[model samples]
Target: MVSLGYPEERFEDVLEERRCNSDLLFSARRFAPPTYKHRCPRSPAALRRAVLDSPRLQQAIREMAGEDGDTEALRQEAQSILREMGHNQGMTVVRTFAFMLSRIFKALFRHVRVNEEGVQRVQKVVQECPIVLLPSHRSYIDFLLMSFLCYSYDLPLPVIAAGMDFQGMRLVGEMLQASGAFYMRRSFSNNPFYWAVFSEYVQAIVRNGDAPLEFFLEGTRSRSNKSLSPKLGLLSIVMEPLLRAQVFDALLVPVSISYERILEENLYARELVGVPKPKESTSGLLKAHRILQNDYGSVFVYFHPPMSLKSFISGRLDITPFSMTPRHMALRLSDTLRVLVHHLAHSVVLRQQHGMVVTPWSLLTTLLLQAPSDHLFPTSCNSEGGVHLPDLLHDVRCLRTVITKIGAMQDWPDAQSHEAVVLSTLAMNSSLVTLTKEGRVLLNVDKVDRPKCRDDILNRACTVLTCAAYRNHILHLFVRPAFVAMAQRHAGSVEDGPTFSHFCFLVQLFSEEFIFEPGSERKDYEEGLSLLQRCSSLLYPLDSQHHPSTITTNFSVFLGQIFQPFCCSYQMVCNYLLTLEHGSMQKESQLLASLQEFALQQLLEGRSTELEILAINVYKNAVASLSRLGALRRERRKDGVWFLTTSQLHHVADAVASLKPPSQLPAKL
Candidate 1:
């Protein structure tokens, strides 16, 4: 049925979103109905304890059918109705039949994108039986995205297992049932009785192949663009029944999604770091709504080929708690889903899935960061292989180039269009101010229909310099000396963890998609000062001597810095300034002073070279920031030779003074 309400642009989007949900039902796997339709939300155990919880609901169901039958009569009458509609599981009450109605209603309020990949592949696997589409969780909106995307792609409408914390939420409750959704207690795993019922019901669906049951494999959204480790609790439902029935032919489809920028990154990061994130206050929520209304983020998704559960079982894949472990399953599934998530994240970054229209902000951001740092300073190049700033037009040149390289991808419009799109996007929303040779062309305005000129070159060069200034700061303080030294220690063990998982989480955090929340971090650290110190030592290189400057070292530094604000006791923050040594000026005197403070009241003996690395990296970070306008790219000569412009070496007393922490470097890394 068409929507029967007033429709406007805002509602148009909302309605489209709803329709997207409806579309899923058309194509989703239909699991078999439970043998008995309880007609109530209460558990059988609970019902065994109570009077008829279903009486009222059953009455409502019968009333909907134009009759007032006794409970037994009702059961028998339900049988007739079931017999009438051969597909009916039980007397499907419109009230209990809410799942059907909701699907139709959803047709009015959703939007989706199921590229050709989603359509063809999903249709084949989902048409005859129930299948789980395990996708990465990165947004609260992920569930909505999955439902809508499936619908748009003409895939089956899945009955999603949603958390029950907000049960009785009139709007939410109605919405869930309407979309063929049911509740699973957020805390029910601990409540064995409820767990059994939920599990059994899910099994019935999968076993009967009435409706496909879907669960997010990760259990939670990933803070970075990477896929998270799967929480196997929910998947246990599908497996338990399969194990019991000795039936395991179902396919597990991995669906992946990526957003231009996750609106919840800051929110989720704070929580992960143990900071509280109460729902925004009403006023704050309203303000956020206004901001969201104006955001122009591109969204992307991919539907991967299905992995058959039966294949695993037949292959002797263990599913028992003892024999088959969640960690083991997670490791394997994570490996499978990680590839899909990477592709999705990459696709969004590159705008390959959806045709990309370069805005002034993106164009300018690319120019600023992608400018060769050497050109900005003119004297910093290494004799070995030099750093290469991606060509401004390379992506525009290669159709197959992935999107995750967006920080440097150049998909400029042809000379003519590039100039126009850049100018237009700038005027619309681009905002970068640079001091340059040809005076200042407002980045947004300069991007206009004007022909590309020497001005583009001048402005980019200067903009590059400014960004470099900040990147250099990051290197000097957190990266260059500190993490680089720490990486040296662990260089041998680096290959132990899954390389892909590391890339997904640690490496991705430094990308533009996330930023550290500079909120009340000091308070947290003060409580766990020792933890920070221990972590600093643990995170730094394995040993003192042989650290090399590699991307991995740079990556470690970035990770340390990202965790710094919340690291509490760690003084490797941008807030601190350098200071005079406690007593003398000998070899590593300043470094020693910093370490002494970090180890203050906690350590029993003298500091080691490892601790010194920690202190020096912080000092270098401050120095780098002080010099490079606050960026973290290390400064090198235009000759491709690297240089150590550490703050300790620089004689800028005033600038060094700015980096001293308000408090001492809490004897931590």
Candidate 2:
């Protein structure tokens, strides 16, 4: 076991408790949180009144209407917005839903593992101050699971920030509202009145400590099963109270929820390949009951110890300006404060990634993608390109050892043998892969019926993308080292300066693709370098002044191939840009569709074998990177036009192409 430098505890199956004593869920004495005791908590109605009467909203109304303008009209508009955004949490409703979810969860998952120590940590810290729950968003089940966990522990039920999409779901919407979900428009910057009311309402909750506030820092569900860059808007709103000294201190808890099998696995994969996501509705919600028929192995929820908002900002920021400014006045975040927020957000994501529990399936998928040929692992594949069962078990064992040694937390059970654990996991995910009578594991593309296309490529892509999602679970552990490996190959030498420069370039180019703490490229480089050195892949310079480092092992080649799909996808995007007319404006939606079609064509023609290139998220990130590099210029037109390509596009394309490995590399290099 790797030490996390904090107290570790055995995971308890929370659902098992629910199963044994269903009555306890209803009869248990819910602990009154310290926030409620320290101050008289505001009722939902009182909170709304406070937000309306707050100095900030009043000033905003007056300013927007002017001295002689109709202030009442703006106030009415603000009231309307508040009505749309506020939550009406009722204990009766919470209990009702909790009971229902208990049954659903019991039917769906074999186990729900929660870190007892983490829960106890929250129980203790919550008594000292208000808390903000930040959970990683992978599926709709995330918020529900969080609330259920909180209810199980008798902790305060957080008032969750939900998107307006949930607000339109008929009776289910009202039930969600009663269960403590407050909806907000996805974007409100264009509406001054709405922004004022929303900000004040959020600040009021923090200032009053009414309930622990909760929100997804990623802003939305990650269809790719990876961390999205943190959204700073809601985070900034919550921190404003501390900055202005409206609240003494608050705790930010980063919760990491890892699923053995995501409920939306197929949906996410299809959506990534240009299939539209089904709308959230009561009918759709009822239709989802079919999921309970299948068994999702387990879920692990790790609540990191609470971080102090005061301590986070103490030495880093000078909050005097915020203190001096009137509470009612709008204060722009200084460049320094913005950077601090960015770092804090990134830090939370890093913590979540660290706390994630890697499943055996994750390691298995990683090996399957990385070890496609026998040269990497002899006898790993059969004549038909399928993985041999025994060889897969051997590879999985080796990978598990390497990954665990590198500090990844694996959820392999102690009660079962390694072979049993591997076989069980494979059976659980049979939809993605299947074992044939011949003792070979093959991708089960035929399981999902699709329209007959020109070729079987798209059908094959569905399975590859799903497998890729599982592989992405443990990617954080390898990304930095993989970058170092790729950089060394591209630089064609192990010189510290050139390799480090290339590493920095790759990090910047793929900034949108991975989460790197802001302004920490140099630190990341050192980390990647250290990991490679640990693997004995790179040797330190003997003469520090004149000599350069050297690659001493083939491990570097193995590491470099981890990002081959990404490099291939990014290069394809650049190549498509090269085909576009110079200075021609292209709508982003049209461009993405065209790119998807182009990728499909390339696949059919065998020009590109990387199935990951079909994902729209990859293309989206590629567009973002190119735009940041000034290769694609956004045309500011009244019609809200698309990007304009510049000559710099060619240079960007060449750079990406240079990083992509040859069509095939020797498995042993």
Candidate 3:
């Protein structure tokens, strides 16, 4: 049996249960597709010819020639661009690579578990309609995993939309192209010819239904490891053909992939702190291959139910043009596409969140992050001492119960399973965590006695940040409970506590710090209340403002601890913004540099944890949030300079700083 990267006894029941009862269509030969030689129609060469000979494209080209000065040279330029952007969907090559990659990846990881039912559902959808596989973006392996899953299921492979970043990798790029990945320029809005060819090429694929299309709606990997607000660039282009009735419709499948350990966790965290990321290149790929000898835990892939565009637009008002015979009908949809794009983008995020898989690493990270900094490691093996194993187990049970009640524990495990998972995870990550001879878990932080090199020091520093990245994967699931605990801790007693409205205000205020989904304030409030009721009898919302509730000794340190670092970091960003010149514009790069310098100083002085508090990406995102809140503005010319929009910088700073959790939170203003 292949390693599933999980303890067999713990996972056996769940996997077998799922396999037996799965109602997925065509389940007989679903997970294992019969392997055979086949050729995909509509090859890259055929797609290019169709695009060039397209009447709509020719008209668009002609219009460009007259209005934008396009000539025979420009026409040839368009053809060349098409050739450059197109991909060859060679089934034999895809199959060969898929088989080889499965072996290579299995050797690299402990387990790779795909939701067999999910794959079956995707296959069923593809048989009925065109599919758009919209997966979350966090690592480069995202598209590779999607393609491999489809190939393994014997379903048609997707024509993946890849960024131009990979196009520079000569042999690798060509191999990717041959394996059904198409290249797209980062920016091609100014080049009408490029746009024409690219649009037509995409339309040809969707219109033909030769294969399903796949791309990350987030556009690029998120350094913070959160689902970024979706980028609508490719989505808009892909939807154009369906909107114009050139194709029947497409099914958008939102896929969420969870890694027991991320390959780029430390690198992503480093990039967040303003460390320059090495460019993706063939040489870099080769260099990274050495790490395959090490074990990465498990990989989980979950596919949400497919959403049809036709059903989505069923009750909505038609943004389509009234003129059915208008020239460039397909391109006309692009003008008013933002509304549709925004809807789909938001849907993708919610679906991705819903489909997220929770593994032992995620659960363990959550527990460790929430524990008191000192108690994170057991001091001794004695039962009456620090971080008792039973206490930890109880806490995990409570967490699993509450989160499951709140609909966030899709993959929650039973006690035996949970224990197995914890033990297995600690064993796998012994360098970062360990089980004492008495079975007490302790974080491994004490340095080795031997002399260390510079690289070793850097690796040790990255350990915390990589752990933070793992913690972030399940962070959103704990938001409501965190908010409730923060509120309870902030209030001295129920009599002097905040009102429900005030708590809601704080949730909105600190939205960006935790990447709260838009318009979820009320839902968060209700869930927080549910958690508070379960965790403590001392805290309860008052029926009237006149009769305030009471607070007790019972409270969750987990809520406050998990959010403190993020809250403190956000306050630091706001404080730095106040130091900027009033009403004066400053380049964002300059602002980030100043923030990084200040953070470095704080780190040197032992006043800050650099990973959580000093990351430049966090500050950059904070500024963007402030801009959304009308606290700042950006220049039009794309110089990345932000203008201080309000004169009340001090007031804004104070407001944000007040939302910090109680342990680190200051007295209420």
Candidate 4:
């Protein structure tokens, strides 16, 4: 395993730095980058013209219009598409927005820490090739934060790909465009003309190599605070320039951003349980200024070393087909290249996860979720499943040690006492947690003045889901070990062969929930096993025949509880699928809604206590896993229809049930 690098200064407070260096934000000399040798630099208008005149796009337009159709009208339609999809980055607008964002961020956060060395490394690479900045999408502030980092470091500002939702906001939309954002519609699969225009616009950017390109590989923000599966559409477009050898090489930088307190925590929780997100508008942006009154602890941004696209595909891919085909013709990716792209995307997410800075709040929340609940709300709240302050401090200390031992960057200060760190963290997230007069920690749902009916369930859900979101920050630290522990329990023995097989199965089942490097299942399994052995969770005897392997009692319980919520959530999804009538079809939206209602009913009846299971993302992943396993199939239709294969559904249910620890087994199961 690679040892994690520790920052010498730990974190540099952006506000403090700004105060020390008064001219840092406004008076620095920005770095100037050279254009790619493949093509001369073109203005935005010239770039649009080039895309419209490209042979590939022209052919697509002709095919869509047909020989007898109005070709002139189709050409005009393509021109309109180009106008809607292009960016107009003005230096004056960039500087004006930078100043405004500086004040807004200073008011919202106490600190924003960045790795100086990482920025310097990127600066060195920017001079040599086109740079692609791939940052994890967790909140709306992500793109703004990236642009700010560039301006602060004097690095070339990146041209970001944005969703059309932002394009409708009056005034704000145009300002964002002027500061370097280009908009695209959510989905345009049926519109070949729009697709042709969008593809060409992105290719022109890559081929020019004038500015760094930025886009979310996940395609959308993660409401659950975990990594979402990569969206391959934009990723493929960027790689096309490299695949066709139009540019010598391009640098792909995976960036990770960690927030101590998210600005959209409550909004995200509400959306997870079926609430529609409010539309983006100038009015909404103005109203959101109220959040600045509160203090958000800190933000950490880490820019990983750049990866060379040419070196990555050196011998693995055969680009001969791409080179031989005319540039005017559409080239489909071969099976091998597609697999390579999938791996590359997953690798970026893994690097992002590894570079995250885990905090004390994350550790405390994780343990809080694992503690048993004796009725969602107890009268006394001083004992009986409520996490006591003293006990929580001790457990958090242990968890921090274990996480550091496994090589995750942690943010605990060496000089502070454990009690101080834990208490302060709890104070910062007071909306989700509270302390009683007797010093017992409890969920803060009771403070909200909601009617005691269905709203009560939702109120509690919002708090639970919000807490779970914080816990997810450190989940990647324990996922592999937790998987190994659960597999051992299911296999009923510690034999390497059976345990490893079960481990592989669990990895495949939860691939959507967790990010595992592709084609590295065997390596990941060995890493998990070795960690378990080091922690004394698993013991391997010198003489296998005489004495078999054994799992330690204490460590087994610790690891098993880490994944209990996930296992219970998957089981709930499978059980719901089993109740559906065989061959009866339901729309995808209807199914998700039904599952949420079903989960709520279980919670009210005391059949389940895992509120985190109510998350829509989890349900989506469960449905995807079922479909992949042949337990559910989606029919080809306008709205799309899903039907269950009764026999296969039962098999999947049984498989999922076996992974739950014996203590968590439902009575019906």
Order of the predicted models by lDDT, top scorer first: 2, 4, 3, 1
State which candidate, 3 or 4, has the greater lDDT: 4
lDDT of each: 0.37, 0.80, 0.65, 0.79
lDDT (Cα, 0-100) at 450 in candidate 1? 20
lDDT of 2: 0.80
**Residues 196-272, model 1: lDDT tens digits:** 33444565566655555677765655543333334556675676445544343666766645444345644543342
RMSD after CA superposition, every candidate: 19.0, 5.3, 7.3, 5.1
Tens digit per residue, CA lDDT, model 4, 1-669: 112555452345666766565443563345454434444766777878989899888888788878798878888988888787788887878888777777778888878888777887898878778899999999999999999888877788888999999999999899888888999999987776788889878988888885789999999999989989898888888899888888888899999999988999999999998899999999999999899898788888888889888888889888777877778877686788789899889988998898888877788877777655432243443243356676576566666667767778777767888898888888888877777777778787664322235687787888888888888887887788778877888889988888898898898889899999888988998888777766543322232221111111345556677677788889999888888887767888889999998998888777887777888889889888778877888676776666555568888789998876634321100
Candidate 1 vs 2: which has more TM-score: 2
- Give the per-residue lDDT of model 3 (tens digit) for 1-669: 122222221222122223334223222333443211222455578778878888877787677778657467767978888778889867556656765666566656665667666677776667667778898887888898788677555777788989988889968898899999999998787776677788788777777776778888877887666677677767888777666676667788898887777788767867776679988899999998766877786676777778988788666646355325454534544444577677777777767866666666766666665543444433334232224455456556555554555455334334456667566777777767766666566556554332134343334345556667777787766667777666655554443236455566556555554544455666767777776666554333322312011111234554566667777777887776777677877777877788777766555455654346756667776777677666777775555455555666667677677765554321110
| Residue 235 error, candidate 4, Å | 0.9
Q: Report how far residue 203 has shifted in candidate 4, in Å.
A: 0.9
Off by over 4 Å in 4: 1-11, 20-39, 375-385, 447-452, 536-553, 662-669
Backbone clash tally (model 4): 0
Error (Å) of candidate 3 at residue 110 is: 3.1
When summed lDDT is taken over every stretch of 10 residues in candidate 3, the lowest stretch is 543-552
**Candidate 4 local lDDT, residue 536:** 49
Clash numbers, per candidate: 90, 0, 3, 0
